[model samples]
Target chain A: MTDPVVKATALRKCYGDLCAVDGVDFEIGRGECFGLLGPNGAGKTTTVKMLTCALPVTGGDLTVEGLSVKEDPRAIKYLLGVCPQEVNLDPDFSVVKNLVVYSRYYDIPRAEAEKRAAELIARFHLHDKLERPVEDLSGGMKKRLLLARALINRPRLLVLDEPTTGLDPQSRRQIWQEVRDMKKNGLTTLLTTHYIEEAELLCDRLVIMDNGRIIEQGTPRQLIEKHLPGGGNLEDVFLKLTGKHLRDE
Target chain B: MNNSLAGSLSYRAWYMWRRNVDVSLVTWKTNVLPPLLEPVLYILAFGFGLGAYVQQISYAGRAWDYLAFMAPGMVAVGVMFHSVFDTMYGAFVRLRYQKTFDALITTPLSPEDILAGEILSGATKGLFAGAAILLVVTLFGLAQYPSSLLILPLSALAGLLFASFGLYFAALAPYIDNLNLPVFLFINPMFLFSGTFFPLDGLPAWVRLLAELLPLTHLVNITRAATLGLLSPSLGWDLLYLVLLTPAVAWLAIAKMKARLIK
Candidate 1:
């Protein structure tokens, strides 16, 4: 509908002789939730890492907000917030300190960073744990903190790598609600998840990947119709597309 | 924000250090204090106990109190020893076990900034520990000369050099626990052989060369020169050696961090 905010053209990442992300191409429109759906080791995280410019390209190219990762990773980093698959906050730091101190690294003004950190703390319902260390918080609270920290920069594009991993249903739903709210504010999102429910509920369009390649792609409804016999829920569609083979990795 | 590039870097470093003081104090309590106190105790037991028998040991000109002559050397050793542990083992835990750098990397700060800030933090811890030991030694009257005040800044720079060394090594640590071997093997030997406990006068030529090779030897020599008026080498040469080492070690720290983070 609009100029693509993120463009991936034949993007690839190789570890020694192994090409984890092999020649995958996709484009995400502005203000849309584009998902990378795949089984484990499907190069989803690799793609997210490359897009975040945390990892070297190794091959091909990815452009975020029209800035090529190759040409301008630092600028790309400034414009995006990456919520990694793992919750790696400083466990020793308090709930609020983690977010505020992290924002300072982005060269964000301390007063502004603290203000946004407080707002996000309240927004994520972590107002109570403002002075408590992160390790003391439950798993769900940590996930929420990660989400809050990610948004502190008011990132132009938000990249979530398996955001819902290790989260319970209640926390997952809370996250879903928050993401929907983010969508209302018109923040573009790119995420990868093995959970079809997350993809179905959040993603506007997604690509099903396998063995470093895209097997199927489109909106939830479109993919079901095109790739399956019935345009049912995302689970049935995923089961049909990926088949009965268990993804051990 | 509106300063020249260098001013901004030092400002950012200071800001980060100021904010991290609580954590840094905890680090000093756990890591720097024990190693610092160990050297002070070594000076008291070894220096005072041996000073009576070795009354007129010719250090510079007049016979100095063995403890007084040894106090500044202990200060130098304290900065080196505690700073090595602070930057090596302590930083290793942050780098590998805690992955604290990963937390910092997500921010807008560059690796250079992180490197600079961490080194300063380590140096501050070193200086703090050295200062604490100096106070304890002063109470014991081992810090005899007025020139002993100069030891503080010299120890701070020495601590920084070792801190940079430790931070550089931290990037190479696969596990935080692996640092014990290097500390025990490399640094401990330097402490023993680098004229910390005694003078290097009686040692063979090769042994003296070994002592000369260590950065600790130069630091101890500089501090001892100030305290005991022993001018084996001028203050300018000693400062040159230490000042040259700071940027050299910082460059290595930046290079190692770049390799680790920019993957």
Candidate 2:
């Protein structure tokens, strides 16, 4: 790949005695969707947090677009559009206001912000809910608005943390369709989720993480073919490698 | 550079401040009502009703009526309440329940930028409330002209000091209820003992010294001087105290918040 959009060399994060993301490495090329697949406590979110500069790196180094996260996090953040795991939309703001106010953080001009907000609103089919408060929107609309807000900055890299974790099938498929469209537009994305189907369908290349380490990394089909040998999907490959015991238990 | 104090801040701080301003605008009626009306109530209860019993008070070495003496104190108190409460309760809600800070960090804003914005917004609220009280006092003919105008800027400075104090407590608070500790223990004492209701000179030597340590005491001193047109060279010390202490506390507040949020 020419000039990877994201590169991590032994990235690590620790909370006192607990090391959440042990040394892990991966790279995502421009226009590629990379997946970090893992169970709860397997450090997928931790690694993502470090990549997004929300959490400090305890050891190792990470660079986005060749700028070190330790050195130029603000610059890296400018290039990132993050949709957090939780719905953090400003409940007091209408859907349009939420997008416009968020655009100010990037120093985007108000007129430009409004124009981009209008475009994203139409794309996400949230034009009808333009004046409605975020709290008033349905679950699916909230998720779609979040995606619209994330795209407002015209970020080079999109970081999604469980974008469709609790959504219904219809909502999840809508999100999947947006991701697919973003991929077609050559927007590089880094996604972390345990849903094997989501990872298999969207990710161009992926890594399976467990106990703060990358246990496997390859194209979804390559991993399935190599791990299963005969006839199984990425889910079977994941279960076989990471074990079926419930992670939270 | 990212971790250093100087490097962590930028013009982006204003955007965070603007975000709060936008929210306040939506609730502008509720936001304006307290500052506009609270002074009138306090003036009736304390300045008129209680002033009748205690007619004259000595301040800045002049015999002044009780209403005139306490009017400036009201402005100081307004500054304290608006700045401290906004940063303490309002900021705590945004930080913990709303996850506003989480959302901000995802963008180009640093933790310092966020805290600076919060403190700035808190100071702006203090200025608004103080100005409102200043208007009320002027209407009562208690505040003198040109000299009293100084209170507007003084309110901003005191606002910064109090806002920093509130933000520090917010960083230390583990739960929303724990914010009450500073209010009851720190702010309540300052409100009563900061020469708002009476002169601190009558108190014991140590008590006066202790009151002097409270930021609001100094704020009251300068504001009282400004409102009464009794500006004195001695008031320079009070101004110095607030000016010196605000930046130190603001730096510490931002550092503490960064330690709490950026881990």
The chain B TM-scores of all candidates, as shown, are: 0.86, 0.97
lDDT of model 1 at position A12: 89
What are the runs in model 2 whose C-alpha is more than 4 Å off?
Answer: none
The candidate that wins on DockQ is: 2
How do the residues A1-249 of candidate 1 rate in per-residue lDDT, one tens digit apiece? 468889999998897889889999999998899899888878887888777766778788899778897776667778888787777787777988888777876778989998898899889999877888788999899888988988888898988888888889999999999999998899999888878989998999999998899988899988777766544788888887777787776
lDDT of 2 by residue, B1-263 (tens): 26887878899999989999898887778775766587678888999999999999987778999999998998999999999988998899899998999999989999889999999999999998899899989989999989999999999998888999999999999999999899999999999999999999899999999999999999999999899888989889999999999999999999998888888
Candidate 2 lDDT over A152-242, as tens digits, reads 9999999988999889999999999999999999999999886899999999999999999999999999998899889889999999999
Please provide, for model 1 over B105-208, each residue's C-alpha lDDT reduced to its tens digit, 9 standing for 90 to 100: 55555455666777887888778777877777778766646677887888788878988888887777777677776777778888888887778887999999
TM-score of each: 0.89, 0.97
Which regions of candidate 1 deviate over 4 angstroms? A239-249, B1-22, B25-36, B49-56, B144-146, B229-235
What are the DockQ scores of the candidates, in order? 0.35, 0.75
